[model samples]
Target: MSFINYSSREINCKIVYYGPGLCGKTTNLQYIYNKTSSEAKGKMISLATETERTLFFDFLPLSMGDIHGFKTRFHLYTVPGQVFYDASRKLILKGVDGVVFVADSQIERMEANLESLDNLRENLEEHGFDLDKLPYVVQYNKQDLPNAAPIEELKNLLNPTNVPDYPAIATTGEGVFQTLKAVAKLVLLELKKKR
Candidate 1:
């Protein structure tokens, strides 16, 4: 759900980046943070374990243009990708307006990707949000790796629903913004429909 602040005339929507461990969720946020102008983004807060893996989430609030009359702000977040952090993942999905599933494209990580995808669906269901109805996109990250699976194979395995997927190398910024823009557009479109 989105939160609308009438006094400030701003609409705040939450978009979560979810995937298995080391799937480059944090890297995507760091790239976006580094490239975004200071004026359009808020301070990025990241809570991590000693190993630097995100323990909870990375929050980056971005202010886009206006909708009808209210300014639209997107709060981007990344749920901890470790399987043990399922509790934390559920917490982060509490009020998500959109989701990006970052699937690791390494051929060896196929099972991990499937497990994480299933976890995403289960977690969302626990919160009463059906994955199929949500504004969602799949990002096949780490595509530059030598052992990365072919795009066709990845599509068959992770994106059978065919909901706006992208090939990405998150560390180098390839397809990063494209993925974000696609999901953000969906989020905004959903918002407009509700108005």
Candidate 2:
């Protein structure tokens, strides 16, 4: 659930980026952190192993703008993508207001994408968040790689519900903001409904 601080007049939303190992979850956060102005973004903190794989999660706090007098601050996170980190993944989903499933675009990683996506749904369910009702988006990342799956096939497998989806190359910043903006918009709309 999102937290609204009446005193601070801030609406803090948590958005988690989830996907299989090496699917570019951290890359997406890093790209945004690098591109955003220092004033707009806070320092990105990553709990990762020495090899740089996310150990627990990656967090970046961003402030966009005021909405009806409340400052909208987004806390973006990326769960550890490795399969064995299920516990960590569940913990990170605890207060998610939105989700961006960063599916690997390579054809060989299709099964991993499916498994990770299913894990996402199951974890969210355990936390009382239904994937179908959540503010969700899908990002087909690493689209620049050779043997990337066709958009249609990817959509069929990962986004059957046809949520706002984007084809992205996170390393190049391609389509990153589009995906973020879409999910953030949905989250804000959900907040409006709650109000």
| Most lDDT-accurate candidate | 2
How do the residues 54-133 of candidate 2 rate in per-residue lDDT, one tens digit apiece? 99999999999998899999999999999999999999999899999999999999999999999999999999999999
Alpha-carbon local distance difference test for all models: 0.95, 0.96
Score candidate 1 by TM-score against the native. Answer: 0.97
Q: Estimate TM-scores for all models.
A: 0.97, 0.98
- lDDT of candidate 1 vs native? 0.95
Q: In candidate 2, how many Å is residue 191 off?
A: 0.8
Task: Give the Cα error of residue 112 in candidate 2, in Å.
Answer: 0.2
Model 2 clash tally?
A: 0
Residues forming the 10-long window of minimal summed lDDT in candidate 2: 63-72
